[model samples]
Structure formats: structure tokens, C-alpha cells
Target: MVTVQAKLIFEGSEDKQRVLDLMRRWSSCMRYAYKRLLEGHKRNELKKQLQGIFNLNSRYVDDAIMKAKSILTSCKERGENPKKVVFGGRQLFEKLQKRHINGKAYKKLQLKWQEKRKGNLYSRGDRSKKGNLNTRIEIDEDCTRLRINVGEREYVYARIQPGWKIKDGRYIDRNQLLEAISICGQPYSVQLKLKSGVVYAYFAIEEVFPQPAITRANGVIGIDTNAYPRHVAWVETDEHGQLLGYGRIPMPELESGSFEKKEYYRWQYAHMIVQMAKEKQKAIVIESLSIKDRGRREDFSGRRSRRIRHYFGYRSLLEKVKLLAKREGIEVIEVNPAYTSVIGMLKYAPQFMVSKDVASSYVIARRGLGLRDRIPHNYMMFLGRLDVNELEELKEYVRKVVKNTYVRKKQLREIGRVIKFLQSLESEAERLSVPLDGTSTGSRGKNHNLWQVLKVAVVTPLSPERVLRDLSVLKSLLVSGQVGKTYKGASSCFLGQGLWLSQIPPAGAGKA
Candidate 1:
């Protein structure tokens, strides 16, 4: 699979004229043959018949005419009738043949149509098109020079000023090309031009193979996508419930506050961390967020939420990790994130009242779920089970309470102000002798209307103190509006229920 790419360099003014002239002559001959065929002459017979008229020394022209004859013969043999035989097909055939013949010396010649036709026959209705193939022309490494054979009588070569150095260990080895095809193998080299005014060639050596599998590595890292400060918490676990290492990479803040930049930086950091983890021989685990949901819009009032969503490239990051891990021979697994955050917080930070605990738990939960079920239980089992339905139910309940509390708080504040205004008005009316009745009207610029105080109390009897304390523990959720006011009334009912069944006890306590 020797591949070659080239860009045109200087073709002397005279050489350009000669090339154009040859092209014109070839085109004219093809047109004449096509016209003869359309005028009721047999195309195959006519193409072969005209071969002798031109000097057969021009292999390019001969090859083109031969191809046209082949196409006409193919169509006739297939028992299909074609409209008109055209010259375009011949012109293309000739150009490709010419390129192949010229590039054959460089071992970069790739001709798909050169082989005998197989399976299908050409039809008259098929459009004629030109072939685009890279014509390999080698330049000497010592000096930028190209080798070309012009006419049957002369061998011409041109040299460019100043040689360019190849990059790394890559070099154009004449011996390699001269060797047998099996020994030469595939061409895995790419040409690169550097800013230092030097051109370099890079080749992939066959020595690099997949790294030895790390069978005993029993740890995994979980990553969470964040907005303001993006970080991936690594909760290292062992065979037993012993914490190993916890690491995080804080994304650098963008000066412009562009979330897209933040996402890019986050991905870069994640990529680096993943590589580092692999070097340390740890498997990576990440969330498999739905692409469609990531882009879905919500009727949110905060501009920050919208900005973060719009700029967040979660799908891209996930895809990048998957691809990079595979190439590096490191396993990357996606686990359900239903309540990883909550579980992570419950298991790791029993005393710490931080929103990150939930996020951290989410990462841990995803990794824990990805582990093989047959693996012996240890810190992973303590991380909790991957019960999708239970996690979703808890998340939904938390979200509903948070939303309801937020709406109620706003309503209460507005209603309180309105009540104060009404009370002041009623007092003034009483002092001015205005009737305190709904139908009362007075002539001394006094009118009265009875107003009923609207009772907007929430029906649930919640313990305000407990709710407040829980709210403090969930500051991140509260600030982000992920959780609503703690329903104090609901807390007691939850205590007797299975609310904390999945919750893990503190690090030192027995598993609950």
C-alpha cells in the first residue's frame, strides 16, 4: 500500500507549452473517433482502425484508444444498447494510463482500471469521468531534484536549490524501494513541512505493538462533566474498603468565559489524565450521556445554564476518550450514572457537606457498575449497587422537592409584600371614617373594599430546622437549583421508610 501525494512545482514555460500541446493532440484524436462512432460507424472497429493513423510511439494515446474499444466491446457483449459513444471516456482512460506509466518507476502507481473488467459490463448511459490518482515523482533527499524521462531519446532531471531534511528517523531509502515487495511492506510514511523551512518525512516503525495487559490492576477512575470548574475525581479502590488515591484536574478558567474553550480545555485535561492513568496501569470509566439530551433545550431563565449547555461538548469528549483508550490498549467503560453523584458523596464524604460529593459519587458509581460481576466484593460493593430504577426515583424526588421549594419561596415573598400593603391601606381607611365593607363608597375622597388574605401555606408539614441543615449539605445542588427546600415533613416519613437503605455508612462504620 504505497501511497504518494504531490503538489506541482515549477514547469518551465517551454515545458508547459509542450505538455499542453500533447494534451490537445490527444483530445482531438479522441473527438474524431467519437464523432465517427456516432455517425453509425462501429465504435470498437473504428477505434482499433484509427490506431495505425497516429504514431503508436505515444503510449498515452494508444492506451486511451484501447480503453474506448474495450468499453464499446463490453457494452455490446452485455446485449445492452447505448445512445452515443463519446470521446470523454477515451480522454480519461488515456490520462490515467499516462500517469500510471510515468509513476511506475517511483512505485507509487495505483491503477484501478488497469486490470481486466470483471463482474459487470459498461453501459452507454454510464457517465464518462476523469480519474484522479497521485502521480508519484521522487525527489532526491540530498538535493530537491526530480527525475523525468522526456521523449524516447533523452533522460531529463532537474534540481531545486537547497535540500530539505527529513524528520525523525524517516528517510527515503533507495535500498528499501529496491528490495522485494514483500520485504518493503506497506508505506506508512507521511510527509510533513515544518515552520523551520525544513521538510520532514515520518514513518511508522513495525516494532510498536499492543502493550502487555495489566491483569492485576484492580482500580478504575471516574470522570464527571462540569461547567464552572471542570474536574474528574478519581476514587481509587482496592480489594478491601481502603481508599488508595483520589486525584482531580481543575480546568483552567477561560479569560473570555467562553464555555466552548472551557470544554476544550477540559477535554485536553481529561485526555492527559487518561494517558497518565494508563501509564500507571489503571482502567478508565466515563459517563455515557445521551447525545440528544445533551443538546436538548430547557426553558431556563439563567443565561449561565444556557451558555454552559451550548458550549459543553460532552459528546465530543466521550468519543475522544473511547477512541484514545482503544488506541492505547486501555479499557474504557461507560456505566449508568443514575445516582453516582449521590452514592459517591454518601460513600466518600460522609461528613463533608459539599455538592462535589454527589458528582464524585456519580463517577464512582459508574466505574463500580462497569466492573465484572464475578469480581470479589470489596470497596466496589461498598460503592453500592447499580440499580437504575432506584437511582432515577431518588433523583426525581430530589428534583421535584427542590423545584417546588424554589417556586414557593418566590410566591411567599411576593405575597408577603402584598399583604403588608393591604394592611396599611385598611388602617388608613378606618382612621378616615371610610366604611370597611366591600360595597362601601365615601364622598370625602374615601372608598373602602374588604380584602381577604390568601392562605398559600404548603400542605406538607416539614421540619424547617432539619430541612435547613440538609440544605446546607447540598449547597451545590441548592445553588444550581438541582435540589429544592428540604421537606421537613417528608423527612420523618422517609426515616421509617427505605430512603437510606442504599446509603453507605461512614468509612469506619459497618456497611448499612
Candidate 2:
């Protein structure tokens, strides 16, 4: 469990009064230190000033400084103006600008605002001090209480309400406060938050994940997140790397929404996927995708690429899946997303009559099972037909076609990305044994590196020449009786930039 929330019951009114006073003073100290931090005061400079101004000793003052500096840092990270920021709710504070309330309503709002401004006490935990120093937990078999040391030898006690609560959804975790303190030395932070007038102690503990019961050796579920149609594609596969079943979960919410709304749906979808894995006793496989840096494709300058890159909440969704999977003892495997889309489109989509996204998930699942893909012999033959110098010729021809025959704005933007994608493949081919054609006229080696096969595979599937549409012709032409039967020494064909990108020879090719 990462957190434990148990109500505190004070023994006497005097203890309650003392705790309230400390809370008030602590809030003041933190607010003052926060202002000082805004003025460029260092922690050491503010620490001495805080101790002298407030009744808090050096340790308490230091804690206040830590908390204040964190808030200041948060404001910087989130692009919020620290000067105009309200300690209480910003919305409530802004209400006075337009006279939003009066009389009884105004009094009610004022009370709430004041409560928020001065209703908290926090003490960071220390491992050497056995979990905590200021806010300490004392547990006997019969009784459990919080010992809050105010100063000198004086302290106040708050008896914790004893009972078991559900932890991490299903696990019954008690205030293993005793276990954490005496045995694990797992430091836990405590914050005394006051609501209405009663103080509640909120403890944040390090979550413990269970040992996985279901593993990748049995079976697995592969997941892929998309932005355009807005759905999460999942494919179930057995340990032998064969597809068993698949489904597409609607994610209309990811199209456009608030961060909170998107997060809620991410968790919701993550839970559904994890539950399916548990029911089938299978592991979960996902592409290790990041929002900002999605591996080699980061340099694509297309609008659709940039928008899709930023829009899909891939990282957040993956994190939630991993965390929940760990809690339920479900194993999760992450595979490189580099060419999953192209493989799915070129190989699986035609074979299974599935969407490109679903096909991609299938590839991801197979990859997680330690399966590798070899370039189809015909495709390898077509690659062998093109010499190293022909790389530049083919790229120029495709660029002219794209410029001459464009369609939708979004389509054009995406196709423009293919131009850069080809360039990247070009760069990857250089200065190493980066195999583009490992055929009998082998440029590099007899064996194909996945990335090398990827170089040629990536060029055709994603653009105007849709691989899914031309799969049959592609098979008949490339997979016919001979390796280079149809496309070999092909004459220049009228190839255009838009859809139906018929492969054409570069001008002056016959001379070459």
C-alpha cells in the first residue's frame, strides 16, 4: 500500500488544542518560507529566519522550508505565477473580484478559505530515525497511537482508529505502521489535514507489488494506443507466438479532453486490459512508447506526426497498466515500437483482415514472445534490384509524385512525414553493416537484421502505395515463380505522388 488513511482520536481537549495551535503555526511558517523562496532565498538562509520567527524549532523550520520550496518548484514546473497564486483554492480566492457572494454565503466562503489557508501539518520521514522523527507511530498489539513530539520532552497523542481497509483495490493492508517502522525501516510521510475542525492524518507509504502469478511464458496480451480513430487495440496470443483473439476498445475520450478526464479513462481502460489478462492467466505486452521522445521517429516534421505524437497518452496509459498489473501479480513485457506498425500493415493486416492498429498489436505480442520476422524473399529480391546509388533516384521520384498528386490536408501532412521517414532510413543504412538487401548479391550479409529489413519495409507500407490494398498484386508480382520476374529492370512507369504509387524507374535508368 502506498498510503494509509486512519482517523486520529485525541485523548483530551488540551491535546486537540495543542495540535490545532501547531497546525496554525506550521501553516504560517510554510507560507512565509514560500514567499522568501520566491525572493530567491536559499534553504539555509530561510531556515534560520523561519526558526526565529515561528515557535517551531530548527527541525520543524527545516521541514517547513522543504515543503515551501517544493511548492515553489511545482509552480515553476507547471508555469503558474507564484505571486498571484492563492494558498487556498484559486477559484475561491478569485470570487471577490466580481462580488460573487454576500452575507451568509460570503461568511460561509470566508470560513472555507481560512480553513484551507491554515489547516495542515506535515513531517517528512527519516529511515535512520525508524520511519519518522516528529510524527511517530507507536503500536502495541492492543492499541495503536500517533506520538507527535511538539518540543522539548512534551508530546501529544492521537489514538488511531483500528481496523482493516482495502489496499491497492483488493489487498487487505492494515496500518502496517508497526511493520514499516520496526522491521522494514520504510520511511512514511505524515500530513495532519484539518477538515471542518477535525484533524486527519494522511500517511503516504511506498507501495508493495505482489509477485506475478501469470507470466509471459504462458500467454500474453499485446496493446497499441492510437490517436486518429481513437481506440486501444489489443491482441491475445499464446506462448508459441500465434494469435488467439483480438478486440478494439473504444477511446473516444482520448480525441480531446481535460487531463483529469483523460487520466480517468486511461486507468479505466488499463484496468479492463489487466482484468482480461488475469482471467486468461496471460501476461501483458506493450510498446515502450514515450510522448516526447518516441525513439528514432522523433525527427519527423509532419503536422500529423507531431500532433499524433503529442495527443496519444501512451506513456501515461502504459504506466497505469504496469502499476495495476504489478498489484494484481500480472507480468507486463515492453517491446520496441520501432517497426511494429509497418510489420502489422504489410504482413498481418492482409493475412488476418484486421485493422492496421490491431495488426500492430499482434506484432508487438509476437515480439514479446521472442519471435523474429524475416523479409519475404520477393521483397528482398526487389530490394536487391536497387543499387546503392539508386536509393537517391527512388527518393527523388517519390518526392515528385507526392508533390504532384496530394489529397486531404491531413493526408498530405502524413505523406510529407514519409519523405523524412525515408531519409532517416537512408541515414541508418550508412557506415555500418546496416543491411537493406541481404540477397545473393549480398551488400552486407546473408542474414537480415530486423532494422535492415525495416529500412525497405518502412518505405512502401505507410504512404500512397498502401500495402494492404496491393497485398495480392504484391504477392503475385514479388512472390511469383521467379525472384525478380516482373519488377526487374522495369521501365519508367507513370508514378504519381498521391494514392496508387506504382513503382517507377528513375530517369536515365536504362543508361545506368
Candidate 3:
């Protein structure tokens, strides 16, 4: 199923007011549903509460609460750590449960949210932003128009102007799409959104999709993402995991850009990579990574800050790739990220004379192909230091971050301090090599290089590598404010919770 979203423009004050009234009522309805959830009221109990509250159909309220619960559930799944559902200013206007298109009963509308009507008519709290009528070019639709069927009292929306500017860089008339929908039957869903008096619409169409057979025949293409020096390293192999080809894809543009602009570019990048996989007739493999944090304490440095922002874009990249691949009938695989980088460096990099990222890509591909127990003995030593003094030192730093006086907003700088300290600690470890055979006492100080010791004592149990991995989780916890007393006492309110942040003067704000 492919979902297409479009921007909408409305004509005439009556038409605009009609859309606004629908949005206002819907928002108010969603707020009510959210409050009921917080109060531990079941759907049936909430349904009863809705019966006498609004003169509108009961299905509207039912849809509101379901959408609210669904949104809340998704947020929780993303590790949002939301203590309460905040229906702040943003209101929801979902597709109605029963809709009528061309007089046939269906579920949804061409346009649709706020609440509370005095008597049977919708109360106009404020209408000072009404505009002047003039000859303006506006996009509108009729056939695909949606009507809210409530017995004999129908709310009909025919044409929504300024339609959608699709991937072709041109506005697609809703009327044209509606004709197509009529032929193809009703879509899966049509969503309405109202923000700052601007209306937006989304249409999701379900179509026949063929299952990807590449994974069954060809192996996967593994991609390793490196943020510090931005690049995507990819390795291609057979279904059984023998490497076939490898290359580094440079990501210089990602290093610096506005968040929105960068996100658009990230989508473009993911699209390009997926196109490569499609052409090769192979499934793609990537690490299952999610970094839902602001930044680590170590991000105070300009370079560290850039790295955090760059890596954060990985989530967006992954999402875009998955969506694009699904639409194209391509298989995408995500494997655990445990030791791909380390294993890549220790086993593949030296053997193939490739960069760490390329080697990591190979490891990621292999891991996806069922080779999980192939770690080199030298790297296994570094993994066995769970009870070492360095770990204690790391814990002390983490505790300091949690106990810091700064608010969550200021924790990035604190994380930077921890990162700086980790760098110094690494230097100290290099200075005091900790011995190779696990037998050198401090008084008998062996002056062997740490990585060199591991190489020569390759058969020795448990060794250390030259580079120390950054404690990313420590930074993530700090950035996400999951470590301490951030957001400990915010109150939840039901009324006036909606926010309209856009200053794009509401329709008629411009002197006509």
C-alpha cells in the first residue's frame, strides 16, 4: 500500500468555515477521548459520556478515541517515555467510520476537527480572520469529495483547493484522483488535518504487492553507517554469506544542513540506495538502530555535535529505505548491531585491507546471513572486561550525569565532559598497557603497546583493542532525559490543550 499526502487550499468563506468547524469539533472530541483514557474509563464508558456531550454522531467520538489511543500507543513504542498524553494545541481529525462518496455509504471525507457547540449549531469562538472574496486560482475536487452521513443531516465537502503537489512536482487535482479512486473502489483511508487554519489531507491506497524473492535466491547487501566521517559502506554477498563486492558511498552533504532540509536529503539518499539494491536484484541489510535522544554529554564539541546530528539522521534514513523498499517489492533485513563494527575491524578490515566501515558492512551482511558465532579470539578478550576498573570509572561518570544540577536541556554539555574524561582514560590505558599474558605486575611493568600485545598474544584469552568504543547508551540516556528528574511533575489538562503555532496568517489575514 502506498500513501499519498497533499496540501489543500479552500475557496469561499462558507467552505472555509465549514472545514474549520469540522476540525474544531474533531479536536475537541479527541481531547475528550484522551481525558477519558487518563481517567481509566473504557471505550463503552467513554461512549456514554459522548452521547450527551455533542449533537454530532456517536461514531465521530468513537473514531476520535481510537485515534487517540493509537497515537499514544505508537509514541510509547518509540520510547517517548510520555508520562501522560498531551493534547497540546494539535488536534486530530480522522476519517469518519461511515462516509458517503457519490451518495454511496463508505468510511471517510475529502475534507475534515474542534469541539463544543452551543445548542445544535457549532459555536464560533472566534471568526475575526475571515477573508475577502476575489478571483483566485484554487484547486478543488467534486467526484472524490467526501460527505459525512449522519442520518439525513449530511456534511458535504466537494472541492478542496491547491490540491497536492506530488512526487512529479506538480499539483494533482483531487477530482482527477477521485475519478481513479471511484474506478479502483474506495481507498484504505483518507485523513484530514487542520493546523493554524490550514487544511491538509492524506490518502492511503492499498494495491497488490508481490513478495520479494531476492532473499531466497541472492544474498543481502549490508550497509554500515559511519557518522563521524559520514559515509555508507556496503558489502554484497551470496545467500550463504560469502562476500562478492564492496564499496564506500560518501555522505559529505549530510555533515551540515538544516534539520528539515537534511531530512529531505536523507530521504533522497535512502531512495538512491534502495534503487541500487533494486537494480542488483538483492535484498538490503542494515543494523537495527534507533537513537531517540537529543545528544550525549560529549556533544559539546563542534565535531561531536555534528556526529550526533549526522547519526541521528540514520533513523530517518532507515525509515525512508523501509518505506521505499516496501513500495518497490524489495526485501529489507535488519540485524542486531551488537559487535558488527568491532568484529569488522578485527576480522575483515586487516584481512581485506579495507576501511573499518567497509569491514563492518561485511560483518553486518554476514550476521544477517546466519554467521553469528565467528568473532576473532583477540577481540573476544576486550569483550570480557565487564568487571574491570575502567567500567567502574564509566559508572562514576554516568552517576555524575544523573546527579548533575543542570536541567535536561543543559545535559549535553555535561555529557561532553564525560566524553572528554573517557578520552583521557583511554590515554591512561595506553600508558599502562595492563599486560598481554594477564600476568605483568605494575612493579614489573611491561612496555608493550596495547593493540600490539593483543596481536602477538592472539591466542591468549580476552584482549583489548587499540580503539575504545564510545559508551553511546550513556549519552542517549542523558539526551533523552531518561536518566534523572526531567519532566517529573508536569500537569495534564483537558481543555484549551490545543495549540496553533503557525503564524501563516489564517485565511483572510491578508488584506484582500
Models sorted by lDDT, best on top: 2, 3, 1
Alpha-carbon runs more than 4 Å astray in model 2: 140-143, 162-166, 171-184, 208-221, 225-283, 289-317, 327-343, 352-355, 366-407, 413-512
Poorest lDDT segment (10 consecutive residues) of candidate 3: 495-504
Candidate 3 per-residue lDDT over residues 207-270, each given as its tens digit:
5556876662587889888776777889988888888899987877777777766776777788
Q: Which of 1 and 2 is the better model by TM-score?
A: 2
Candidate achieving the largest lDDT: 2
lDDT of each: 0.40, 0.69, 0.52
Better of 2 and 3 by lDDT: 2
Q: What are the root-mean-square deviations of the candidates from the true structure over C-alphas?
A: 20.8, 8.0, 20.9
Better of 2 and 3 by TM-score: 2
Sequence-dependent TM-score of model 3: 0.58
Error of 2 at 383 (Å): 10
Candidate 2, 1-512: lDDT as tens digits: 46677788999999998998888899999999988888888998888778778878887888888988888888889998888768978887887454758888888788788878898888988878768878888877877789988777789999887367643334454656444643567778888888777788877767777889899989899998877677889999999988899999998777777766677777788888899999999999988875343333345666776667566677777888899999899998989887687677656765677877898899899888988765554444444334444554445544554555433222334334434433444442352223342121343232324333433333442344442343433333333412112343445322322212234222223433
- Per-residue lDDT tens digits for candidate 1, residues 1-512, read 23222222334656533433433444455545545654666645665555566332334344445445565667688885644543334443555566445656423222222211111111111012111011112435454433322344433333333222221113454324322221334333222222121222222223233653532255655666655454445554443324555556554453246555555564576568667657667666677776233222334645665565555555666666765566677766676655454344322343344355444643453355443211112222221221334334333443445444654444344334433333444342243333332222343213321111111111111222122223243332222312233343354232222232224232234434
User: Candidates 1 and 3: which is better by TM-score?
Assistant: 3
Better of 1 and 3 by lDDT: 3
